[model samples]
Target: MKNTKVYASYRYPSQVISHAVWLYHRFTLSFKDIEELLAARGIIVSYETVRNWCLKFGN
Candidate 1:
């Protein structure tokens, strides 16, 4: 199998990180917006964390 390297050292799972990043890029949403969206879904992540995920995973 091919090795997919994303979320290597992240505390959250790849799915969560991917969703947050996707939302930020796909909708051009702010990091705080993404964080609030996640919180509504019971994820409870900080905007800074979302920003970090974007920097790390975004193109």
Candidate 2:
């Protein structure tokens, strides 16, 4: 099998979430845009949290 990383090996959930948030925000999409997209897949995150995640990580 190919080598694959594991979630347990992840050092920061915030970092990953931040990355996703950045991608979501840098696009022309609205706040609710990414929020609903992720929520449809059961991410259970608020748009406010996503905004914060982007700000914290983007800096």
Candidate 3:
């Protein structure tokens, strides 16, 4: 198995974090927009959290 321990400390799953980062970069979407997109998918993440994720992982 791949060492996913890097993501172990986060509250949300790695897939969720990765997808949020992907959406922000791939489409140049705003944090609020990404929040709504995830919300539509039943992921209740805040825009602030999205912003933090982008800053931390959206290299």
Task: Give a tens-digit lDDT track for model 1, residues 1-59.
Answer: 13346567778878888889899999979999998999999899999999988998889
Query: In candidate 2, what are the lDDT values of residues 1-59, reduced to their tens digit?
Result: 12223324534364457546676757787667778877887676777877766665455
| Lowest summed lDDT window (length 10), candidate 2 | 1-10
Give the total clashing residue pairs for model 1.
0
Lowest-lDDT window of 10 residues in candidate 1?
1-10
Q: Is candidate 1 or candidate 2 better by lDDT?
A: 1
Angstrom error of the Cα, residue 30, model 1: value is 0.6
Question: Could you give me the TM-score of model 2 versus the true structure?
Answer: 0.59
Model 1 RMSD to the real structure? 2.3
Give model 1's TM-score versus the native structure: 0.87
Number of the candidate with higher TM-score, 1 or 3? 3
Collision pairs in model 3? none
Alpha-carbon lDDT, every model: 0.86, 0.62, 0.90
Residue pairs with clashing backbones, model 2: none
lDDT ranking, best first: 3, 1, 2
The residue-level lDDT of candidate 3 at 10 comes to 89
RMSD of each: 2.3, 5.8, 1.7
In candidate 2, stretches whose alpha carbon ends up further than 4 angstroms from where it belongs are 1-16
